[model samples]
Target: MKVDGEVTTGLGKAAYFLSQEFYTKEFEKNLGFIPYPGTLNVIVSDEYLDEINEIKCNCENLIKPDEGFGAVRYIEAKLNDVIVGAIVFPAKTTHDENYLEFIAECKLRDELDLKDGDIVSLEF
Candidate 1:
């Protein structure tokens, strides 16, 4: 289906295929492993500044991993004057680096049209 100028061929159909064939190969060649699924908080708003602030607030409230292997970072994607998506990274820490998962959840309390907010708890 076409929405605006973008196409949605069903939930994750495009991203899944792209990730498997293109993203995975490219990422592995450039980076390393197939990107693991990580969580992110998506927030959309007209006020970009406020949206950024909200992302910061959410990250501050995020629960840190007990193993000291991961942390949460917020990323905001904007489309023109409107905020599109807010991403939260639950990342793994290496000796001198960090790797974030590829799944995203919500952190905002307001009624925003975004994905659900599910707290991620993992051992590895």
Candidate 2:
């Protein structure tokens, strides 16, 4: 799956959850790296929303929380051909379908030199 959209800012609270030792440890173990303390927000294109939602409907498609954390689905993707990351949707999440959150081992914004409204390509 591939979804392209413009980069956007988040509500400025991801660090509270993402920076937790539990999730970072899990990410490092499963996703292959410890993510930065945040996610790169993307407003996915409307054309791809349905496909994303469809995956959400499939129970097997989601990555459940390790034990105490909220559930999230992980979709592996490539960013700009140089960086690798995943689109994360929290099962008990706050984001709308259009707003997909990208997480990488590195700080996505710094590595990508991204700003809000910059178009980002995500290939799964």
Q: Residue 79 lDDT in model 2?
A: 83
* lDDT of model 2, residue 49: 80
Clashes of each: 10, 0
**Clashing residue pairs, candidate 2?**
none
* TM-scores for candidates 1 onward, in order: 0.26, 0.87
The digit string of per-residue lDDT tens for model 1 on 9-116 reads: 123322332234443454344333444332222222233435344544566433243352344453433222232333334343221112122231222222223334
lDDT of 1: 0.31
**How far out, in Å, is residue 89 in model 2?**
0.9
Worst 10 residues of 1 by lDDT: 1-10
lDDT of residue 51 for candidate 2: 84
* Candidate 2 per-residue lDDT over residues 1-124, each given as its tens digit: 8767989989877777787776777677777988888889999878898888887666353545567778766767788777887777786667777998888888888887899999988887
